[model samples]
Target chain A: MKHNSYFDGKVQSLELHTENGVATVGVITPGQYTFGTSTQEKMVITAGSLRVKLPDQDWQTVMSGEFFVVDKNVSFVVEAEQDVAYLCYYF
Target chain B: MKHNSYFDGKVQSLELHTENGVATVGVITPGQYTFGTSTQEKMVITAGSLRVKLPDQDWQTVMSGEFFVVDKNVSFVVEAEQDVAYLCYYF
Candidate 1:
């Protein structure tokens, strides 16, 4: 029952329970933001697209129905060209 | 730039801009709630599942990647077993 809203309310998330693990479904407005994670996160793009720059990796555009993973304790940058909807599973 | 959270923060949504129309990406906790709409809405389930009862329609379960529409000025009931993530487009 975690409802976290950040970045001036431009980004918001709802905690979810899954069979495998804990996940979050969130939405991001058109902007760039940095994120830090405590656990390995698998982020799936459910709508729109995200321009992501992972650690030591080039910027990549993740589209809808696509997914990307961020290592635990890692920080990343993401830019949304449009309103981006994502589901992130923590492991 | 609308971030509206309802039902004691159990439900949250972020306004989105799409090519076709305005949409909302939101998440519902494990509860039953009634929603009133001012415009026609096309709700798409992106993750988890939702039990929805539209006007004059039976209680229907909408799974991930599925969708349902509600007429303008109508009200509907939706229940989530787990956490339900949805994208709603308004027309």
Candidate 2:
């Protein structure tokens, strides 16, 4: 298993293998962070909600059970008013 | 934000405030771990699954979206075949 800590540990994730591909379960604290993807990413919210702003897109709220996709080599901003739990898949 | 690492960092959690109370979102590695609680806990599986052995009870599998409760001052054993994501409410 791989453990990742980002933004001075405000965001953390654990790497896992899933049938679809490699995935990560992570938590984001109450703050905003920018992420750049190396592969096409599908991010699913499992707890709380995240306000996201993708490149060339308006900010949106992704609630629990909702998901968003980001193209490879793109950057996105995610804001968490409260703690948010998420699972992200890389393809 | 509070971060907890247990079992030499095989399991990790982040503290959060919920409507019900204080809670933690965490991930369990693929192994068996023993946990002791200082407060009553309701653990909800959010991803993958957990096989749990509560005090004086037989082992049971709790899948995603399912929950199990444990009283305060008790100990339990949990096993994960894959990385399992969970939210635990403490009261």
- How many collisions per candidate? 0, 0
- Per-residue CA lDDT of model 1 for B11-79, tens digit only, reads 887777877588887878889999999999999998888999999999999999899999999999999
Task: Quote the positional error of residue B87 for candidate 2 in Å.
Answer: 1.8
Best by TM-score: 1
Go through the candidates in order and give the C-alpha RMSD of each one to the true structure.
Answer: 1.8, 1.9
Write model 2 residue lDDT over A8-89, tens digit each, in one string.
Answer: 9889877777667788878888899999999999999877899999999999999988999999999999999988888888
DockQ for every model, please: 0.53, 0.43
What does candidate 1's lDDT look like per residue over A1-91, in tens digits?
A: 6777899888887777776588887888889999999999999998789999999999999998999999999999999978888889999
The local distance difference test score of model 1 is: 0.88
Candidate 1 displacement at residue A65 in angstroms = 1.5
What are the chain A TM-scores for all the models, listed individually?
0.98, 0.99
Off by over 4 Å in 2: none
**What C-alpha lDDT do the candidate models reach, one value each?**
0.88, 0.88
> How well does candidate 1 score on lDDT at residue A11?
88
